[model samples]
Target: MNILTFDVEDWFHLLDHKSTKSEKVWLNYESRIHSNMERIYKILDNTNQKATFFCLGWVAKTYPEIIRKIIDKGHEIGSHSHLHQLVYEQTPEIFKKDLECSIKTIEDICGQKVIYYRAPGFSITKKNIWAFEIMHELGIKIDCSIFPSKRSHGGFPSFKNQEPVIVSYNGITLKELPINYYTILNKPIIYSGGGYFRLFPYYLINKWSKNSKYVMTYFHPRDFDKNQPIISDLSLARKFKSYVGLSGAATKLETWLNNDQFLDVSTADQKINWNEVPVVKL
Candidate 1:
């Protein structure tokens, strides 16, 4: 009835507007990352559930074995861009290059075509919507790039507040599986589905999902790492948003999996396809 996803990158891959930050530091955590991968591998293996991993191309290129491990375990592989650059910040030319680089790297490592992509920070907004056409040009069929709600990172402040909707982009009809949101009494409420998902009370997440029709959830590998290095100059809000709900992420995930019926994003989309023509009789 829902989809569970993972954005597979370490905590340090985050770009903040602090002093200065660079993703080059992501390459420094080889052993820890691999260990985290193995931990996720074990958890998914035991739970008998598969999740879509929107992996960083940098991670795929640097650790091909980890990418292979994901495929070998029967999980879906999708791109999260080559450098983790925010999509809205780049020119269309640059965005195309970044997306292609990630796609090619992922295909090379997994030996399968990569079809799904989740833009960094969900930065695919109105200003940069042409990027979706470019994605179709490059052969991507599914995009999980629109947050459909506001967040501190980069989100459309006025996209649909509930449910994933299909949007036409650049003469193409690729599925847009926007991230999940919960609205209480017709007002929007943000909960643990990404960073917030891990930070808040797990019971609330369960309750929210139980009351909703479509629940799209995501977490990052970095979330499971309680010992991650803290950002020194992060603003109070950024720091709070990033660190508030981490320690219980893994446990909360296990609980959600045990309770919910989930499919990877692609599979869920296929199911939606088979079930509807999206027309109403007048």
Candidate 2:
């Protein structure tokens, strides 16, 4: 199965950056989420595809109509956390508060229970496995926060499986759908989302998709917005990673939409045989 997802945040929601971290500073930047998301909506509409949008609570609060529009079009809505903070950087108490705030905000706008989550930057690494317990308490049924391979910001290198698995914490169980990866020289490499989706050639992606039994592809609004203003103060490497393949991203996505069948994460979760999936004890 192919699961299509989008991390719904504005252009300025750069991960791990001190300058753009604050809510006040976010207010200073021009909001491009609406227009950029419209571009995404057009693409999905033309292709008759439905996706899961993991929206930041801040975005929902700022643009409630956008959340309504996404739901109106029959797409799933999932939480991307409030304020876009990394889970590893937060205490359990702080994380719970932020999660509750995000769920409440999204639920208030859409009038539906928020049951799916994807951490900002995939930040629920080994250091924060406790996050699963908290999410279970919050009634989340599935989590897509564990990036199975090492990442610069937050990744779970100790995680053994890339496929969907059931995680048991206390008495609650939550399904973890780690980001997809492919083996290279016997080592797993991620090409399913973000900069990797932009950086890798389409042929390699096609090969990986054909080989994998289940693939979850993720993208952000910034990926398709090549005209976005470059952040001048970012490190050279960061600048390149963020902006290198912008021009071709939209075309690549359109190609995939035309060729493949995709379902939103929640629907995919429902279709899976959870009893047959491996269980991980936390």
Clashes of 1: 4
lDDT of model 2 at residue 50?
Answer: 94
Give per-residue CA lDDT, model 1, range 147-167, as digits (tens). 767766677757763455566
| Model 2 ranges with Cα > 4 A deviation | none
True lDDT of residue 12, candidate 1: 71
lDDT of prediction 2: 0.89
After superposition, the stretches of candidate 1 with alpha carbons farther than 4 Å from their true spots are: 17-25, 28-31, 274-282
Tens-digit per-residue lDDT, 143-232, candidate 2: 988888888789887888888999887777899888889998989878877889999998888889889998988899989999998888
